[model samples]
Target: MSSELLPPNWPAMSIAEANAALAAPGSPVQVEDTVIDGVPSKGYTNAPPNIHSILFLAAMTHPERDYIVYKDERVTYKAMLRAVEHFAATLRDKYGITKGDRVAVIMRNYPQWPVAFYAALSLGAIATPMNSWWTGEELEYGLSFAGVKAAVVDPQIFERIHEHLGDLPDLKHVIIAREPGDEHNHPSVSSMEDAIGPANSWADLADIGMPDVEIGPDDDATIMYTSGTTGKPKGALATHRAVIANMFNSLTCTARMYLRKGEAVPEPDPNVTRATLMSIPFFHATGSFAILIPTALRGDKIVTMYKWDASEALPIIERERITSIGGVPAIAWQVLEHPDRDKYDLSSIEVVSYGGAPSAPELVSTIKRRLPNAAPGNGWGMTETCATVTLNIGEDYVNRPTSAGAPPSAVELKICDPDGKEMPAGEVGELWCKSPSNCKLYWNRPDATAETFRNGWVVTGDLARLDEEGFLFLVDRAKDMLIRGGENIYSIEVESALYDHPAVMDAAVVGIPHKVLGEEVGAVVQLKPGMSVTEDELRAHVANQLAAFKVPVEIHFMDQPLPRNANGKILKKELREQFTPRG
Candidate 1:
């Protein structure tokens, strides 16, 4: 099925051939054999050794370039470096923070978010970014779980977790950025403005020089928490090498794309300012590893928003000349379908890519039709993989819209059955990935670490199949699959069919308990604004594409967008509860 989608000369050369030239010895993204945590693995030989080193190099290469843009504020690379240096100094001298200590960063997508993150990392402290959407109790649980010594938060987050501070004995210091008018005063709390001043004034601060701390490539760098859908969230601890490997892997993918098109990779053009709309939360792996760090290292501009709004984003894309804009399919869809989108000059966009959820196949054609200048892209990854294991972009994505593309030279992917045996091509099984970008382990959870990370491979819970050409087609999450009358049903298939309907905007398929059948297929759909469809019409839509047993036995409609977690994944457990019987 996949082979017919590509031409005989398409990609110009094989993926293996392209990698040989791109990752050859002495090349920028050279690959080398290495050992990580006693497990054999492959890594990027020429990548930056640590996050601090990358920050320093970025500052040196683009001192006057705009690094961050939020509302009316713009921070240059030089100014951002000064702020990170001063903040790191304060963390070291005032708070006695050092290598291996955990410092929590809990805030929205504010410019200070990156400042706080880099500050902690620069001082060799483990930067733990907790979800800003977590409630006070959830936030407290994360702080206590990581044994955080200090936290940098915004006013809203500070208010949310203030009362719970007494429960966190390890939390010794708290720094609030952009605090509102004289609020509740705590003995351990301090103002970020007082420490680093406003973003615009950072250039005037005295440079204390980069922190004189020794950091190794394999040292612990970040502890990102997974979404706690089934139970308590677990921290996925990653090393400096793991995070930096993702940067190189991203670069390698782009280089491969150009080579596949029979074109030489373009050199870095300092005159052309590359920019992206920062829509996703920085805590998520897709936002931090895939978007933030990569763009920062390239000296590109990041335009942030307090929250994502299509109406507000349309102008930002035009005003900032955003070259890339995507976090998830829903985000890209909103911008593409916006009523006033045609009113703005969005011709600056070149790529519209998304991941972390199932996207409709029609979305690819729609993007090509709506924004003729942009190429639609998709991929598959997880928090444990530190984002981006396989990516499908440009012509490859347009041809195989449902496939998750292919992995790069530094990464290995295999499909395994329940008994841990590798599955043959075209057979559905759990997708497992091995790469230097994979997280080291789950913090404080040995059982989970042992179960998920096997010999450097992260056993992703998603069920998928690879084609002859190595294109991945996700079936469904292992736990989310429904069995009806002994027949297996993958929800994504039904949801995709529902999305084909012109009126359907978002859809999720859940299993409803039955007396005789054991379980029945059920669907919940959100229609496009001002568009309507009958339940019978939607059922017929899916029935046409799938077997009768796969059709939803019942359907429910919602006026609001589907409920999603911070990672932009649909909360199926919540949707399932609606079908439960009550006394």
Candidate 2:
């Protein structure tokens, strides 16, 4: 810890410096150009051997640090590691769960969720995190899709999926958490507390260490299911290499900021733990990649809310001294606009950021206004690219309010025309991104995988333009683009304009059927509480900012919030389905 050993001006290393260091020989995250699983892309020469290697490395460093926090219940890294060991051992010894076996973890944001996830991973099994918000039918599809061998669920989730349990042939084990005394007559069902008996308890298991499963970086790890807006949700299978690469990317970026601010990469302190409010469900990549994985690397405490409630979140932030808030754009909107915001002591918040949904430029400024000390950040990526490959923060973010910021050095983003030719800077076209953080494949759908994962690039559905400096401004999802007669309209362009209006709270623009024009612009808006506005007035508001064709041919208002999936992304397809276009 000598002063001269660190960066000259700052005790912390800059991202540029860190990047240089990473590229050097013997660096744990050092980079090299090579083909990974037939995809020519950037990859780590020193990527962690497996998921357990990464988790265990963290636990060994900060064993006593707080890992999970819910209400007054706190679980330390040591405790979590022990549980993971016990669960992994029990699954392997008692249940015959082994490598490549799929274990579905269906539950709310509880401490046991992570334990189950890591336990399965520790045994070289694929951890399938099914959407907690899914219905019985959806749950059945997921279990059947992954061929789930076992599932660690809670009582409430069991009730939702129990009806369809008979349909899943491969499901052999069910360890239900939170329902202590209840027992199931089903052969597979057992309470979580009863399963982790004294014979294979955490105390006994911690001494035995990880199982003898040798997992390589390219080995199967997570089968994260997509939102399935169009059809059945596709499971994006991420490798250990892909997941760990993302973790380093986040560290490099944050370290870059810390150095810029003349701060050091603080040593892991058990008492002085960094806290984040976990509002996003873990099923989403944003929750897993951007929040959960990165926080674990830093040994930071994650405080989970059973469900998203801005009121509940506010107190947790104040009491836990939560340093950052993120997940979805709606969470930020709700927090900054909450009527009872003044009642809580929310000064501890230092960062506010979100993605996975459309964001108005105004949401950024609103966050800065409410949390004066907090820096507002926004970025774009999808389930395919492991959440965030491009991230914009600080002055770069404030200056270019509309852009999804620039990609990290390890990631590449490009705009291409309809024919797949590269577009010049600032020209709008399909956005394609390539990175090691990109998932390996779409679980079992080879044809879909071939179509999307071409030549190491994720053929993102987003239509975007990149400035000369590489700031990406997302225009719309290519499929969502509307055509009115000969005129083309980007729904996001129109939605952003509507968001500029004072009364507009949440808005979505879609293309409705039109006999002559093929399709016409349509808007569904949820106004601020008690606010009223004419449809024509709102149309005029958009017309002022966009071309005439982009103005909504139809405007529908709603008394409630728009429909959203587990990730807080508005269900545009559902919105489009709600209306029958007139001739």
Candidate 3:
């Protein structure tokens, strides 16, 4: 794709023209209106009924295509599918994983995570991918809430679950991924090597076949958990329709970007497969449905990271010839700002994308200055919206670096005042969106679901103003949720955990700005009179219940009662101002 072909005034030309061009007949990306969940939403007409069918079709079509690249492991489409089939059969035949059963996955960016996820879905079971960073208590809560029947987890996670086995009575099977000859290491654990063979052992599973199960778009496909103000993680239920719609939304976006730039639609790469660096945790909606599933179906290779490291990433990009990288702003910033960033052959990168963190306007210019060959991309959405509703890419992205860009054709965005009255452009209010990408509900939390998802619109907690040009400018947030290194941390969740300690009478949490991680978690607490608690003690208390990332990096002890409003709610905005250092 040559930027020379793009008219100098092409961006001066209306964005509508580019969008319309993509929607035109015979265009690589096409759109049509359809009813989903009783809402007349726009969606890709050619999308599969469910993700299982799509992955199955891709495996049958491009059996030898490289699906995943992790360190020395290169799993082809056929290999992954066969593993999925073998595991799905084991889940059903051996473990009695019937329809609607919940199967859990707890692992880093290992190949088994996808294999476990698909296998669970392949048998009509709901897949629950708990955060790999979660503690035993957090994982137990998710498992118990979703009534997880079986889980395919790594040895480290298995060690955590082992402590809670007696607590989780419904959890029958614990399939642990162990090394060769490390089988039967635990009395209750089943070796993944024994169950599914060794890593990259594709030839051994040539005889396996996909499961014969009837799945519908409306069937529950996943129960991914998201944090809220209540501290407890709520499992957000999403049907196949929602996930598949998100997958298609990604594909269409790519097709449109190439077509609008007059670049030929991307075909299967011959020298190296269309590769991406996937360091984001697979449990996130952005990682699972948005990037992982779409990349898999296209037969693109995902270069996995065992854990995020900028130095480790540089070499993978050079050796693997990774064309696309990024799932978080921190990843991009770290890579470009690395002391030895220029020492590697980073010229292979064509696109860099991230979201969930508040991006500095200067970050945009930095990307352009350093990685001139790559176009920077960022989008907005949350777990409720399947992680992408609006994306700014290419020239449009560079022009309006601060704006979140317009919603895709399949997504509709609107602003509403507190009373639910719709607001016109330029008014800052709650951002409500309607799209097939919206998940169904907050698992088991009817009150939260009713208040958030209402009348065919997901009432996003983001406060934003839409310009007359249709670009969304986020002003603030309605919910006191802060993103730290792309992971969403609800202030109330941390506060509730702090209050759990008897020594703490009142507590408040706020976001402290950080140059690298976007924001760091900070806490203010007032202990009970005559009671003593050290910062380390309270921090350890919170860590036991929540993930380590959610633990406060900084803590302050307050002697007087924390500031409060007339309604008796703690004033967090005031705390952020008082506690936050002057920039």
- Measured by lDDT, the strongest candidate is 1
lDDT string for model 1 (510-570, tens) is 9999877888999999887778899999999888999999999889998877898988889
lDDT of each candidate versus the true structure: 0.88, 0.79, 0.78
User: lDDT per residue, candidate 2, 98-148, as tens digits?
Assistant: 999999999988888888888898888999999998888989999998899
- Model 3 residue-pair collision total: 0
**What tens digits encode model 3's per-residue C-alpha lDDT throughout 1-583?**
2355245755533556556666666654567877777777776667678888877887877789888878888888888888888888888888899989999998888888888999899889999998887789988899999999998898788778788988998898888864532564654567666768866895468657778889888889999887432378778899888898776666555555555566666775544557888867888888888778888667677888887778899989999988888865546766876677889999989888887644555566667778888888877878887777777777666667777777766777899999989999999788999988888898889998999888679998888889886788776566667788899786656765786776765677888888778888899887655689999999999999899999998789988767642112356776777555422
Q: lDDT: which is higher, 2 or 3? A: 2
Q: How well does each candidate superpose onto the true structure, as a TM-score?
A: 0.97, 0.91, 0.80
1 or 2, greater by lDDT:
1
